[model samples]
Target: MAKSTHDHGAAFRAGYVALIGRPNAGKSTLLNRLVGEKIAAVSNKPQTTRFKILGIVNRPEGQIVLVDTPGVHKPGYELNRRMMAAVHDALLGVDLVCLIRDASVSTGHGDRFTLDLVKQSDKPALLLLNKTDNLADKSKLLPLIEWYQQEHSWRAIVPISALKGDQIQELLDEIIEHIPVGEQLFSEDEFTDQPMRVLAAEIVREKILEVTGEEIPYVTAVVTEKWEEVREDFTRIYCAIFVERGSQKKIIIGHGAQRLKQIGIRARRDIEKMLGHRCHLELFVKVEEDWRDKERLLDQLGVGKEG
Candidate 1:
């Protein structure tokens, strides 16, 4: 919550940049890499990020506030609609847009749809072809680069491997150049804007995504109902995992509630790492039929609230 109030001088440039892309495009990976910390929860599942997470990157010359958004996808339920709205919301105030694409895959209708969203933003953009390390032959990327060039006259096109940190400095340099000269918006030490409670919930959800099958992640949501720092080096948390049906709940619980216990163990480890303290995490599952469509539950869950 601390802002950098001192003047950073005329050489400094700081502004918000939206990392817009399709699902599983490695936007969160890039954000974490840029900020040098794991503030956003990452998984291979589509639409893993449901809110606009602000990651502050401090440079000697400037600061970059990266706004990581939910993936661009066809809205189905109310949750999907709210997720898409977060993407649109990110575009409105950003100084630049970095459209992240998975270079290892073939471009399709979804890619085009994402590009359309960038075009609609009417802001200067840089095309970042993420996951380039997945390519065995780097020369094969020329065609994909050319295709994007023909689609839109971008400010710059940079190929980067977010996972392996390839060409990341070049990408950062390009980003710093595009943003206007201004003072720093956030403290240099502050990496992200997410509260501990929201992050705890996301960590539990990420564990669920990691262990469960395809269908469960889309219908599931996690809310941290309680968080208390019980001691100087220990904390206690109680979280609720809401599913749309009893069958889904059963799957999450597993036989003798083993799967749920595994989720808590994994989540607690990450939470302890983040807080630098031992944590007692209790996870409870509940069936909330059609909860995604319920606005009140969504409000309580902080969906679309960051936008």
Candidate 2:
């Protein structure tokens, strides 16, 4: 047998932390707050997060890779199935699991189901009671925290309001304390690991969600066709919005392309803000009948089939 020596010279604390919760539990909001940036898309609708978004948070102690997962829900379609699988995949190799629950609402089956997943995992778990600011009596939170502590031996119990930024710093400190020492995974300045193209597509998709209502937003997909950086100042980007039918395309385009123009203007402003530079955005509407069901299209859209 050969002896191996472990190298601890470059020891630093860094690991993956997954945020799991029910629909509209403010997981995305919490992630953005922690990272101090809008990396994950946010919407009022349920299941707004369709993928496991990796947000990198750098601190003086170490780096924390936050995985903002899609809201766990019963799948109603193939897309939903893929989204749920993303959530499951994020659980693997996670150092800490922050099970966020809306403090204003009572615990339900959805919360229980996610808690069961955490209970089975060997990873350390933290119960995050979100939306504490909305609660009338802060004293009521103690019982809920006690209930969770009784149900499971959690590593820590934290009450916070992701929207109001209450107790967020304390939560970050707690997470950092539990992270084991290891080498730095990313540079101090790097905020996220996501590529620019993926982020650009997400920006447009988020705009779609913001502009439209009902099932149309869910059926929509944004694809960037070209990205041309002009000199060192600005960039010109072209994208196509895919819909399932001609009727849906018309809805997105609206009368005389008014809706599409609105989406473009808003998406451009957001992209510029995200990139920290001006952008010339061009948006077009296209009908890709049942693209969600098409394996090729789904794969092209980065919605992989493998779990």
Candidate 3:
């Protein structure tokens, strides 16, 4: 329950805050809700966020810079190792840590892995029991909160539904309280720090996550090859979707290229909405022979230390 002694309400506050939890625990959804925009791509699939994405929330009184990271999971591949590294790096130099838990489901080993990371951090940690709307019994929340309070002396334990916009403002107020007194970390007009190329890749990857299920989800990665502004009102974007095997590529393309068409159509719409411009998007499928393990390819995709 350790926290700053400064009067946060009396002074302007600004600092970095990280959202960490088990896979599919609604951490990305909660980040989007707090930032008031879809800065992070979310899917029903686990491990959707592959890197640490920064989102800014500017309030009337304080500013919070949210570092949205990949879900906590065991590393079975080089890609998975890079993802876990992002989580460790985000833990450094943060004012507060908000560990979200999927309240609707029973806690398990993955949840324990996240809790252990929290125990190692010296920052003030806040436990957000997200997706409480899915709970059948509202009375179950009290015991849930009490149990977590004993687990870790959190600054606050708040129940919220990030999807249904329930108690969102209350969570924001609690977050502002934990931030220390300082100047604004980012400008008032900015919402996220993600570059255009990375966001395009993420948007395309989100479509892939939604369109394809099974083993295809983990074997896929998107790279934006070209981003050209044809005119002030128009943009032409081309991206390549890399898979480890040719069969995987064929599955993604589908019969008569129907599935690829579907992915492109859905992804283009999201890209247009995000960029606020008319977009012409082209998607191509390629077999990279396990590109995730290749350090050279991963650096190009923005996962290396210098990347």
- Worst lDDT run of 10 residues, candidate 2, spans 1-10
lDDT of 2 at 199: 80
Q: Judging by lDDT, tell me the better candidate of 2 and 3.
A: 3
**Native RMSD of candidate 1 (Å):** 4.5
Give, for candidate 3, the lowest lDDT window spanning 10 residues.
1-10
The lDDT leader among the candidates is: 1
Listing every candidate in turn, what is its Cα RMSD in Å to the true structure after a full C-alpha superposition?
4.5, 5.8, 2.5
Predicted structure 3, TM vs. truth: 0.95
* Candidate 2 C-alpha lDDT tens digits along 15-131: 889999998899999999999988887887787888888889987767899988889899876777888888888888689998999889887888789888888776898889999
lDDT of 3: 0.86
* Alpha-carbon deviation at 246 in model 2, angstroms: 1.9
lDDT of 1 by residue, 263-303 (tens): 99999999999999899999999998898899888887778
Off by over 4 Å in 2: 1-11, 305-307
Which sequence of candidate numbers ranks them by lDDT, best first? 1, 3, 2
